[model samples]
Target: MINPLGRLLDENNYIVSDGAMATELEKRGVDTNSALWSAEALIKNPEAVIAVHRSYFEAGAAIATTDSYQATPQAFVEAGFTKAQGAQFITQSVQLAQAARDEYLANLPREERLAKGGALLIAGSVGPYGAYLADGSEYRGDYTLTDAQYRDFHRERMQLLADAGVDLFAFETMPNAAEVKALCGLLTDEFPGMTAWLSFSVGASSTALCDGTPLDAVATMANDCDQITAVGINCTAEENVTATLHTLTPLTAKPIIVYPNNGDIYNPIDKSWQANPNARSFAALAPEWRAAGASIIGGCCRSTPADIAGMATALAAQN
Candidate 1:
């Protein structure tokens, strides 16, 4: 059973997903300091959110992850939105991405717009529970929550996103195997038609998850789940790219997805973001990433549209 994403890889060798939702939003003057992150734009500035997606599309992002990574009902309710409103906001996250795709397609030459293959896709983002806590615990993954508890925590938003209609799930920045296991189970049991891509954040050691679990063991867990269509790393420092890819590419037969951040560091505890002066050159590294077997690549935190466009242009030039 070939995943659709697999077909895209076969055709193009690599496809670009969008770069940094919150970081891009902040560039447009949206305040991302709240627990909601870019999810806030889904309510007060949906059109602004849509515009960002359009920017990425114009810049060559083939997939746009929704602006709902931090948009759980609990978070919204805690921020004073009602449960129903929270659900609508989640659904609207997909809507905004779709709107961007449609608008982008509409403007292309008819032949380009009507191309039978490689159309844009929307990935409903499912941020880990620790993301809601906003305490950087997502990078620690030492929570005592049971598997069922984790599943319970993710259920509502997952269902709403599925109902809203997305091409796949982007379980972004997961730090442990447990959350991956829990979400994979629920996808199998609940959203029968849905498949997901799981991207883990590498920990202090470049070869391990933030929880210190070896990528090999985690890759094994992900490989056993039929619901997961792809597996790789994201939101990790650019310096970790080579080791992370070396550890992962051999471990999974699935397509590799690697979207590393600029070497910037974020402290969820103090909500401070300091620049990593040592950040690697993202554009110069794309060829190596492709050579190393990353079939899907893009930028995460601090990666701009120009950065993604540069990668896309580079791939085009190679052909």
Candidate 2:
């Protein structure tokens, strides 16, 4: 079989899947918010990461992301590790995904495979520089970093993924177009052969990104970036996606990928994120998104393996 992700984009069609959240997964054992847990968990429980990846693939995900989103120097500080110590964690994240892919492919039926055989694509996920601000405030006023500084930090982590043979580098959940543009240029300049996938969080109806850049502007940046293969949204409101999708389809020629959060904003008081839209929602919407020109479909926050399985069934039926 052709690469599932490559085929999905090549045909300008939607292929359903799920994106795993390391925060939520780590929460099961250690309070996800705790500092020591991240360091300990990164070393002690590669299985947990592997388990999540296996679950997504078994549930029918065409792609699985590495657990490297939180492997930054600042995150290491929060996790009780020195900046220098983060390298091992970053390398391990890639290794964890590779293990999951190997195990998944091995378990496939020994016979009846296609001529090209099954190849699972591993996407290395990179998130915002800082953890979601505790209060979700804008980073502009409180802190500012030169483009070079930002590139330096991101490049260190990107190199780990590239060296470990990641199938793609996903700049995911970015709230600003400028950040994405800089990171894209930095990566493309460094790793010219690797595929880049850019995803934004739409804060509202009018903005391409949460920071309020025009949707066309995001499209233009994604297009101009040498290695960008796809662009779309993740971590936006479900209600926000419909209009955003409509707006995005006409402005950009690239394949659109959508993975809105399953639950709305988390309410710290009750510690619950409500409005559970399951796989059925994904099943129902995948076609509409495809009709609107989305080439990939998946889940973001609060999405589990079952959600991906549901999407897979939906995609198979539609195809």
Candidate 3:
């Protein structure tokens, strides 16, 4: 099967992905303070979830990532859902995104829709096991699990997403090398015909992953995996992006995807975001990030539709 994302990049040079789902949901008056984070909207306010995805597409995003980042069975069970119910919710996440994509396209004129790039794709978001913890361990990468354990935790959701018809998988915000390896292996061994992008959660230093693994080391591992179509960083500070891209560009022939946070620091303790005086706008940084070699660009935590619009405008100016 032809990879639509690859085709789009071949035609357009860069692909614009959507911004943070959780951030958008919060703006829609949904409560996301629970362990499920944005997944809470899946159960409580699914229409709101659809609205968020549509807003991003309207803002010029060519890809819409699902709200399944924290929708794992373990998390749902801990939050008082049965495993089967959790599975349904995971499937629902994909459907919600598809609904948004369909609705967005229906209103657009046929010519405008065709001109909006290629088909708008839905990336099934497979967040790290740390996201299941909901305690900020994703940033620290302080957890450990055997390869079997990691695959077991992820398999059900991957299957659900595939069955629900996602365009690709997004193994995003990953911090642990072992888990990354497990996921890559699982994708190859089980989910044939699927493609994915692996984006890391890096620490303050751009040279290292959140787990302290050298960026070059993990990036090289991902680049070697045939099933992974792109490799780079996400949910990290915007300041770390260009440097992280510089480290990654030489390591992989795959496209580099970077969607850093909105230049804000997250206090995982209170689960609140604090503004950084030094944070720059995505419009201002888009040219620099593109110049540094990112072929897929968007926003992460605390990023809004406006931020994506700015990045899209900035990238459009490049051609």
Candidate 4:
């Protein structure tokens, strides 16, 4: 059967699912602080991760990314592992994703498999490195590493994701052109068959990434990578996505995927994340996004399964 991710690469207007973040985990009683070092929970609570995947699938997600975004070498380092020790942590993270994929496949029905063509896709999520440039131009918020150091950090993580056998390599929340270029090249060289998808964060300029890289530059870089099948923006204000769609629509022929965050960031002081975009509002934007040439849709930070379900229904109605 053709892989679902491959099918997404071939088709237009696809719906990929986004995983729940710390907010959802908090609802599940996982303290945000503890989850940082809780690698064992991925295995011990496999059900939690699988349930989230299944939720998106039921919500009409044609693709599901693995819960491996924070499994980076730098993330491990921050959680108290040495550089060498961090390598093992990253490798183990990929293995967790592989296990999740295997279980997801086992749970699917063989009779419907032919029609679905193994509709499930395990996407390995690569986020920004633990560093930044002057003037807040880092892909990640850590703001401690330089561009060259970030490249090396991503190289090691890309190798781990490649070794994990994920069907696709997705770079999410990239703030700069340099790191995005390095990641796309690294994955293409190491995993020839794996597809690449990218999502850049909206910055102060609204169109430029946090690193001051323009949307067109990001799209151009992503398209130049032979393995990149899609490129778009994520992890920004919801309204910004609509603008981004317009900015990116005319730039390239690659399919676009978007998963914007709720309008406001969640700060303990504001507690404003508790008051933000609902599923209906997010799903309601699907048609607008699709018309603007965004073929793939999903949600990002602070978005839940219900939000994904709303999007699925909206897309189905359009089709």
Largest lDDT belongs to which candidate? 3
Q: Which scores greater on lDDT, model 2 or model 3?
A: 3
> Candidate 2 residues 76-134, lDDT tens each?
76657777677778878888877877777678786622421444578887876643343
What lDDT, from 0 to 1, does candidate 3 have? 0.91
In the range 217-240, model 4's lDDT, one tens digit per residue, is: 878887787688778887776777
TM-scores for the candidates = 0.96, 0.86, 0.97, 0.82
What lDDT is reached at residue 103 by model 2?
A: 78
* Candidate 4 segments exceeding 4 Å error: 1-6, 9-13, 34-46, 81-89, 95-109, 130-147, 188-191, 268-274, 277-280
Question: Which pairs clash (backbone N, Cα, C closer than 3 Å) in model 1?
Answer: none
Q: Write model 3 residue lDDT over 21-70, tens digit each, in one string.
A: 89889888999998999999999999999999999999999999999999
Against the true structure, candidate 2 reaches a TM-score of 0.86
Residue 97 Cα positional deviation in candidate 1, in Å, after optimal superposition: 0.4
In candidate 3, the residue pairs with backbone N, CA or C atoms under 3 Å apart (3 or more residues apart, or in different chains) clash, namely: none
lDDT of each: 0.85, 0.68, 0.91, 0.65
Of candidate 1, the 10-residue stretch with the lowest lDDT total is 1-10
RMSD of model 3 against the true structure: 1.2
Who is ahead in lDDT, 3 or 4?
A: 3
Clashing residue pairs in all predictions, respectively, total 0, 0, 0, 1
Off by over 4 Å in 3: 115-118
Candidate scoring better on lDDT of 2 and 4: 2
Candidate 2, poorest ten consecutive residues by summed lDDT: 134-143
